[model samples]
Target: MTDPARSALMSKVKGKNTRPELIVRQELHALGGRFRLHRKDLPGRPDIVMPSRKLAVFVHGCFWHRHQNCRMASTPKTRQGFWNEKFDANIARDQRNAFDLQQLGWRVEVIWECQTRKREQLSASLKKLLVPPENHR
Candidate 1:
């Protein structure tokens, strides 16, 4: 694709309220998970925050966050150096944010974009994640 075309496509990509994030939010709500959106006070402004549970959720796109071993994380044919640097920076930032949140006594969970593609699976996963270990029995 041409530079202009690529630029337009990239611009259309949203940083918040993305389809995956919305799907995750809906599933979480259906599972009775009350949460807040993008709490600015938090280290990385988590996509979903369950204050009572002290949990922070980040809905990350596989490509942008470079999900390990995920098909969607494939690099572009062009701009190898640029993409690598960008991906590295994103990963570093994600690690820093998770570390800071952990230090603050908050649990951090990452919900990948591909994981939200199936409603049933997403629901089941959310249920498992939300349940406290003590209540597992």
Candidate 2:
């Protein structure tokens, strides 16, 4: 593809309220998880912030965030150098943001895009994260 076409496509890719993010939001609502969106005060402006639980959730795109062991996180065939640098920067920024949030006493959770593709698994994971673990005695 030409540079113009690629640029146009990239421009169409949104930063917030993406389809994957929306899915997570809906699931969280269904599970009765009350949260705030993109708190500017927080590092990296987490997608979902539950102040009551002191937890911040980041909905990450597999390809963009370079989810480990995820097939969807593969590098693009074109612009190898550019993509590598972008992925590396994204990973670094994510690590820095998570660290900052943790330092400020906020628990951080990252839900990858590919994970959200499976409704059942995603629901289970969300429950696990949002719900307190039961004592097995």
Candidate 3:
């Protein structure tokens, strides 16, 4: 069912504008928030970076980033060990990246593809990222 040509074409595609990225970006825009997309100076080149708030957002694919307890996360029947290590490394690195950003005094937000795919919950989840409760008013 997979088209070889399309698959080959898709493999070359990377960076933001992915489905999850677009979804999150659209919702964030609706909230009237502005951010830089993938600034190279950052360690991870976070998907959405706001210098004013020192905030970073990462839009993660459930399958690729190995979302914990997600059905989409599956090891290939072949080379299971390699996949496992890669998945574990990704998770570990993700943690490290967020920790490093935090150490630099940045507030990090991670949006999982699985979470964003839920249409009913996407707005609320995205809003939570863009707006933290204000201490005043």
Candidate 4:
């Protein structure tokens, strides 16, 4: 695709309410997890926040967040330099946000887009996330 075509395609991509995000949101609701969406006051405006639990969840796209060993996280065939820099910045920002959230006493969990593909596995993981540790119980 030409540069203009690529730009237009990328422009259509949304910042929120993406397919993976919707899947996660639906599952969370099914699992009885109540969360606030994208609280601007929080660092990185986490996708889901449970204030009572002091937990923040981020539903990250594999390509944008550079998920390790994920097929969906392939680098673009064109613009290697630009993509690398963009991916690097995104990773850095994610790290910074996670660190900030932790410092503020919030436990953070990141759910990759690929993980949501398998409903059973995702449900198990979500159960673990929503459940307090045995010691806490």
Candidate 5:
């Protein structure tokens, strides 16, 4: 690939609701769950925000968010240390964000990119999350 192309790819690599996020959002909407998307004021800008239920979801990419023990999360050989540091920071920040949100009384759920690979299962799981505990019983 050309240098400009590589640069463009890196530039577009952001930390936000990507394809997986959109997929989850679509499933949740179909399940009758209404929520906000990427609220900047929120601690982590959660991908899904259900105020009445006080639940926040962070749809994480397995590679970018570093899913522990996941094969797809392996760091690139080139600049290994830099990738490790960045991935570690992402995990730490995710923990801190979830902790802060919980302390403020918001329940947090993390969905991984690998999970999205199993769309049917992920859809069912997301439905479970969206459903109120009382309603489940």
Candidate 6:
């Protein structure tokens, strides 16, 4: 596609409140996970923040975040150099953000877009993550 078309398409990509994010939010809420959205004070402005649990969740897009071994993380045949640099930067920033959050005593979880597609699995995995250690059997 032309540059203008590609730019327009990319512009339409929502940074927050995306479909996958909304799905994760719903699942978390169903599990009685009370949370805040995008806390600016935190590194990476996590998608979901549970202050009581000191947990920060990032809902990452497979393609944008370069989810390893994920089909969604395909590379563009054209603009190879540009895409590589962009993906590398995204990965680096994610690592830095997670490290910073960890240093601040916050537990971080990353929910991939592909993972969100299966609601049952996502809910189960979230339950495990959100459940308190004392409650786990």
**Top lDDT hit:** 6
* Model 3: residue 78 alpha-carbon error in angstroms: 1.2
> Cα RMSD for candidate 5?
2.1
Best-to-worst order by lDDT is 6, 1, 4, 2, 5, 3
Q: Give TM-scores for every candidate, taking all chains together and pairing residue i with residue i.
A: 0.95, 0.93, 0.84, 0.95, 0.89, 0.96
Question: Model 2 shows how many backbone clashes?
Answer: 0
Ranking 1 against 6 by lDDT, winner: 6
lDDT of 4 by residue, 1-137 (tens): 99899889999998888898899999989999998999999999999999988989999999999999999999988889999999999999999999999999899999999999999999998988888754444
Which pairs clash inside model 2?
A: none
Clash tally, candidates in order: 0, 0, 0, 0, 0, 0
For candidate 6, write residues 1-137 as lDDT tens digits.
99999999999999999999999999999989999999999999999999998889999999999999999999999999999999999999999999999999998999999999999999999998797655769
Candidate 4 residue pairs that clash: none
Error of 2 at 32 (Å): 0.9
Better of 5 and 6 by lDDT: 6
The candidate with the higher lDDT, 1 or 4, is 1
Candidate 1 lDDT: 0.95
Worst 10 residues of 1 by lDDT: 128-137
Q: For model 3, where is the 10-residue window of minimal lDDT?
A: 128-137
C-alpha lDDT of all candidate models, in order: 0.95, 0.91, 0.81, 0.93, 0.87, 0.96
> Which digits, one per residue and each the tens of the lDDT, describe model 1 over residues 27-99?
9999899999999999999999998888899999999999999999999999999999999999999999999
- Give the least accurate 10-residue stretch of model 2, judged by summed lDDT: 128-137
Better candidate by TM-score, 5 or 6: 6
> Roughly what TM-score does model 1 have, to 2 decimal places?
0.95
lDDT of 3 by residue, 7-121 (tens): 6975877767798898888887887888889988887889998787688999998877988798987766766797789889998888998988888888888888888878669
Tell me how candidate 4 scores on lDDT: 0.93
Compose the digit string of candidate 5's lDDT tens values, residues 1-137: 67698789999986666888888888888888899989888898898899988899999998988888999988777777988899889999999999999999898999998898888999889878977756866
